[model samples]
Target: MATMPSSEACSMALAMAAVEKGTGDDRGMETLQYSGWRCHRKIHARRPAGGMMPAVRRVPAHGSWQRTRGVMVASQFITQLAFTLGLPFLPLYLQQLGVHDPQRAALWAGASATFSGLAMALMAPIWGRLADRVGRKAMVLRATFAGVLVVGGMALVQGPVALLALRLLQGLLTGTVSASNTLVADSVPKNKLGSSMALMQTAVFAGAAGGPLIGGVIADRFGYRWPFGATAALLLLSGLLVLLGSREEFKPQARTQPSRSERRARTRQIWLLLGPIIVVNFLDQLAGSVVGPVLPLVIAHLAGGQQSGVATLTGTILGSVAVSASIGALIAGRLTGRWPPPQVVAACAGGAAVFALLQGLASSVLLLGVFRVIMGLFIGGTLPAANVLLGNLVPPQDRGVAFGLTASATSLGFAAGPLLGALLVHVGLRAPFLLTSGLLALECLWMVWSSRRLNSASG
Candidate 1:
């Protein structure tokens, strides 16, 4: 734990010595208590009339909070792994659903991803607002259970159109990752928020890494549809784990009626604080999703082998990217305290832009895999950095809607990426990567400009 600042320490020492001197200066002590609390809500520096450090009383609660954090992280890992299992094979699934032409497959892949994203984008804020009123845990349960239904329904669809519709519904109902993140944000101490968010992000990357490798093997052995069923089972298991292992004490905000001027001012303040962060979040995901729709086909073309062999090779590439992302998340979690998140985000964006451009130029699968892994390392930091910044910028009571808005931005970016991919893939497989790189580069410049503007305004 960090010690109090020098001024706070001095006030605390004087307050204690005064009490010890048997002065019984009630008004002075009360004033000190109020001042201490005002200076920092996390540190309860003042003591009772005969007292010791009141902050010490909060240690046991902190320990419990740590335990809760552990449970949520584990749950997040399981849920993410389950959720992402089908993603690597989405284009393959489209192939099985009656699309035969590669160009059309790419377009459909992008369209399906965009459809899901649009649905999720529409629903995220509603779920987020509901989470604040109900409980985050409830939202997690709702998402996982909905995943069981929506993903499982994918198994029953007969064509690409039906599959896309189910996926759209899936987005409407499922947001387990977001729900788990909200839970983590609510549970951790204020000072440890970034670390906790980073740790959760690592779990996300781990699951993303593991799921593709496992799902690829499963899809190869049992066919594309089995993975959906398997994903449903995993979602069911995750829901059970959350129910049995985690606890949340939720208190709904009191309803208040505000004047139009006050509401307008609040809305303007929110826009000023969150607008840039949301755009950055969206554009980052958009850059990454450019590869999602056509990666398997690219691997298949490079490997020049049976479908089964291609599936395995594609999994290897996907897993490598995810594993690199996990490593990046670990590094990002450590660096949040040392560097400002916007600076980190800008650096990561620039790095991703460079690596993505390199990926576009690669001629072989091996070279492409290497570039993607490097790109993943940079791409991984973006979300956690944005989340940490959002957490700090918004009050706890409003964070659900704030994160929801970010989620919407992310979905919008994700929706756009594949569409861009579909359109560019006709030019060549390399086009999407180059295009994404250009978008990311543009984003980096914008973020740097925004950060400088904000800094100058503050100064």
Candidate 2:
């Protein structure tokens, strides 16, 4: 956690950290007692009495948090795998519904994804806020079980229009990633957060990397709708895993009644501090998703008349990109160590932009796959650099709100990108690819400008 730079940030930190890491264990409950809480200079550094990191007295909550981490990571993998199992085939599935034309199918596919993204964007903050009040585990259950219904219903949809409704509902009701992350964060101490977070992310990549390929094979052999049923079952299993394996003794924060003026002032402060970082997140997610809906159309086009195996082929390409992206994320730390994060972000965005353009020009599936896989490497770098900026830029106490806004931005971006791309599909399949390149180029230019501004200010 970054140090609080101002008295306001320090105060906010104190308010937010009250019931930090109180959870249940195998033998019994481990309660947090803030009775002897003090900021000892010997233990850390001398800070003001109400500075960040107020020491707390607590019973070591056994190894339950550790176990919780394990269970949650597994749950994350299963949940993500379940989601990707059917989502990536939306365009192909649209053809099965009634839209046989590739261009029209791509449009509906993008619409489906956009509707879902819009719902998630609208509801994310609401659900995130409620997770504090109602409980994170409850939110996770809400998301998981909701998916069991929404995705399962997708299997029964007879038309493209009906599918779009379910997609939107899926977004409004499900946010397993955000809910699970919140639960894991609340369940563990701050120091171990990095490892816990990394593990969770690894699970996401692992599941995503395999899900498309596996789901594709299933679709080819059985049918498109079969994967949807499989996804629902997997989601059920994921919910059960988290429900039975993990425990949360959640303690909600004491309600604060800040004045209207005070709340407005705080909102301004957050915007000033986090506005650029939030934009970066939004654009990053936007760039990543813009090509997703139309990739199957491109693959089918390149494959000529062999529509029979397009599902499997599409899945392979998507799975490969996911794997490459994961590897890129893993190596980003080393790259950041050698240069400033802004510079790293700029470099990677530039690379991604170049590769995205190459992808648009590729004549064959193999060439397109190569270009996308390479683009994924650069795509992966952007997130880690943005995260570094967040750590450096946002104060510890203020990060919760910062991250919450970022999540909203991400959802909006995800919703916007595909819709924008789908609109571009009217021009040509390659138009979306060209658009992805343009977005990444803009992202690169922004980072470069930001890097120069930071360097000049420091100099």
Candidate 3:
């Protein structure tokens, strides 16, 4: 439960990372040339010296992809639900484990979450690279199964160190959202990439938005440990769903591997196109996570010190934000069809900033929840817009690593945000919300400053 982010989904590591479904040499090479409601892109990889397009073979969907997509969506929903079930309650659980002081519990929560994100940041690209070698389905299985062990172990932890260790293990082993997206993108047809990915994102959002509501009731009634058992069970079920339901037609492309120097050169070029996008991804995740670990603490404060029902209130508030976020993401995706992605991103970030400020100033949990819901709606758009901009600009060939790096950047933000939130909690419960607002404002400013440059460069 390490708060091991990016939402992992919000990383949009699948931002057309899915159109990778090629039979033979097409394996993961070509991205759907996504425009509005369209396919993906390809940063051409190792073009032949004879001036030929990198031989990309498009595999027809065979009409089975939609069925496959339905299963994948179910698996993703369950996976996200399992992750969120125990997440918002981590500090509460820590308090149960003897970190009784609210600030101390928040700090412990942040520390463990920071480590989990650090582990995930370090591992995301390695996993992404490995997925290229193995089948994407295998990576998806690995990620989901890893969750079974991690969450199951979390249930048995008796102290902070044990919890921290499990969280590190969670980061090292699990990245269900990212892995699942790659596999789905690999299995679904090119034409369906946008809809499939959007559905997948919605699954993540729905689970995140609703799971806490359920977890809150469970924890309030049964104690924090029960949610762990429940989460583990749900993860196991999700893993089984993916294991049995999804099919992978990916064939590792046969190609002479590029030398390290060549790979490095490609990475540098990818970074050039990706630098602005990466910053946006990082900020988007950071802005979201800053409030994540701190929210329950804020709720506890607003209620005049934690006594009872804090988990339920916290869950309600977090759930509201997530519900709004889902709507925001859909709206953002639609608006991208009409507006420049950067403009959409700037508008969303600006709106999120205003709401976040309002959230910081709220005196009651209901008002705080209301502001957070609005902020969620706006912040939710940031990722999809940024990802659209990325998918359109980064050559499809480089996008695998490009998206991996974005995941890494997102993970780094995930790692940093909670720690920042924890430190701000020392200032006051309101400080984290204010800091989150500033981050959103800065995110908006970054988009405003770079929108024209990014668009022009892509042109």
Note the clash tally of each candidate: 0, 0, 12
Per-residue lDDT of model 3, residues 1-459, tens digit only: 112114344224234333333442455465432221112332323323344232232443566667667888898888888888887899999989999888888888888889999998899888878877676678778888888888888888899899999999998888877776666665555435445556777777878988899999999999999888888899889888877877666655545578997668755655666788889878888888887777887787889886689998888877777788888878877777777888999999999989888988899988988888888888888887776676566433334455667788888899999989998887888888888888888988988988886776454
Which residue pairs of candidate 2 clash? none
CA lDDT of each prediction against the hidden true structure: 0.77, 0.75, 0.76
Q: Write the per-residue lDDT of candidate 2 for residues 1-459, one digit (tens) a residue.
A: 222235455444444334423332222432332211121111212223554444333332759788888899899989988989888999888988999987788788888888898888888878877776677789889999999999999999999989999999998999887677667666665445444554665577678888999999999998899999999999999999989999877655444578997668766655654666677778888988888888787888888857878889888988888788767766664665556777877888899999999999999999999999899878876766665455445433233344556777888888998888888887888888888898889988887777754432212
Worst 10 residues of 2 by lDDT: 35-44
Give the number of the best model, judged by TM-score.
1
Q: Which one wins by TM-score: 1 or 2?
A: 1
Clashes of 2: 0
| Every model's TM-score | 0.87, 0.82, 0.85
True-vs-predicted CA distance for residue 177, candidate 1, Å? 2.0
Model 1 per-residue lDDT tens digits across residues 96-193 = 88997877988888998899899989999999999888988899889889999989888778999898888789878887777888887876776788
TM-score between model 1 and native:
0.87
Cα miss at 248, model 2 (Å)? 3.3
Model 1, residue 346: C-alpha shift (Å): 0.7
